[model samples]
Target: MSKKILISVVGPTAIGKTKLAIELANHFNAEIISADSRQFFKEMQIGTAAPNSQELASAPHHFIHHKSIHENYSVGDFEKEAIALLSHLFAKNDYVVMVGGSGLYSDVITKGLDKFPNVSPDIRKNLNEILKKEGIGPLQRQLKVLDEKSSNSIDLANPHRLIRALEVSIGSGKPYSSFLNKDKEKRPFKTITIGLQADRSIIYDRINKRVEIMIDKGMVEEAKKLYPHRILNALQTVGYKELFRYLDGEWDLEFAISEIKKNTRRFAKRQLTWYRKNQDIIWFDFNMSKADVFQKIDKEIITVQNE
Candidate 1:
């Protein structure tokens, strides 16, 4: 049996993943499967940077604007859906690309996700109550004592993950880390990972500029439309969270903007930390010529094809 090639473009925020992925998809006769967790929601186009109309038309993309903030979606579902899509795409094309900065989403597509025993609904309900009453700080404290390893990898700002880990730790009588295994699962296709990076100042400047562009594109209205649903997990993202504060009059507009910049810089650092820990990725400077990046991609493809 022949195997199709999977090319994954990943890096910190504002590192040009979308444009590069689209161009690479066109070159490799591939389609793009977006691995960004936030970009999945149709309501979050501006903040999540869902592919513009031109990029969507450039090469077929999947998992972009496929869900609503009101609906529930998780990494396990993403892994299943992405594998199914990869199988279908492989039937038609020789290569497929999955692109995003979301580490968990990327892991789902490239590495088969480990399934954990389900926690009781009642436990989840109580956890929610605790989160509502005590706030995320208490939950973070519990996680530190119960499953510090999981806390290190998962999103600390997310109430859903924190509560879920607590419930699992109590119900299953095992550390949440035990549920996350390092054992790799075999897949039908081979995935080659690419990382994009830039000088620290340049990347930070790009992030600041991107946030400004989002505002110019009516990000305020976008967040306003979803403000009523602010409690949802999807709205907890950096841009939305900061804007939510502004809508609540917790801080003035200027302060909210400053918080967005600070939070985004932190998010970018976290993303780089995740990617840097993985030895499989080949890093490219973001300032490199388009041709140079393509040449590196071509070399990887040739290596995979020969293997």
Candidate 2:
């Protein structure tokens, strides 16, 4: 049997990942499965910068705006669905493209997730209540006391992540990080990881430009429509969260826009930090032309297949 290949285009937000992935998919005549966690919500198109209708029409893409903001979709859910979709796609095409900036989601599909012990619902509910009443600071402190490793690694500001670690630590009497990388499920295919990056200033500039374009393209309107659901986990992401403050009386529109740009740059830095740990990835300048990138990928695929 021929070896199946999965090409993953990974990078910071607004680094032209979607365009590269589409071009690669078209070149390889393969389907695309998006790994962007924010782009999963159907109601968050403009804010999420999901593929427009023309881009969607250019290639067959899956998991783009496939779920609603009201739906609770987890990383585990994406891993299962994406792997299953890859299985089906592999039966027809030898190559498929996976693209996004969500490192956790990509890691799940490529390396498999660690098995975690189930914590009681009571613990989770209580944590949620504490978050609502007190706030994330309490939970962050609790996680630091219980599982300092996870507290340092996870987004401490994200209540959902902090509470998740706390619940597992308090309920199972074990640190959540202890479960990671214990047992990785082996997949049949080989993944070619291509990382796109630019200088810090260039990346920040791109992010700022993208934010301005998003605003002009009606991101505010989209956020307004979803403001009622701002409390949902799906809406807690970078772009929407900053805009939600504007919708609320918490910040002025100008400040909110500036905040979005600043937060997005921070998010991109975190993404680079995560992706840089893997030494196997072949990095490319984000400004590279499509032909040059495609040629490099083709050469890499050939090299991998030859080995």
Per-residue C-alpha lDDT of model 2 across residues 1-307, encoded as one tens digit per residue: 5689999999999999999999999999999999999899899899888999999999999999999988888888998899999999999999999999999888889999878898899999998888889977888888888998888788776667777788889999999988888878799899999999999999999999999999999999998988888888888788888888888889999999999999899988889988987888889998888888888888888887887
TM-score of 2: 0.97
The per-model lDDT (C-alpha) reads 0.87, 0.89
What C-alpha lDDT, on a 0 to 100 scale, does residue 99 get in candidate 2?
Answer: 95
Count of backbone clashes for each model?
0, 0
Give the per-residue Cα lDDT of candidate 1 at 82: 89
Worst lDDT window (10 residues) for model 2? Answer: 155-164
Clashing pairs in 2: none
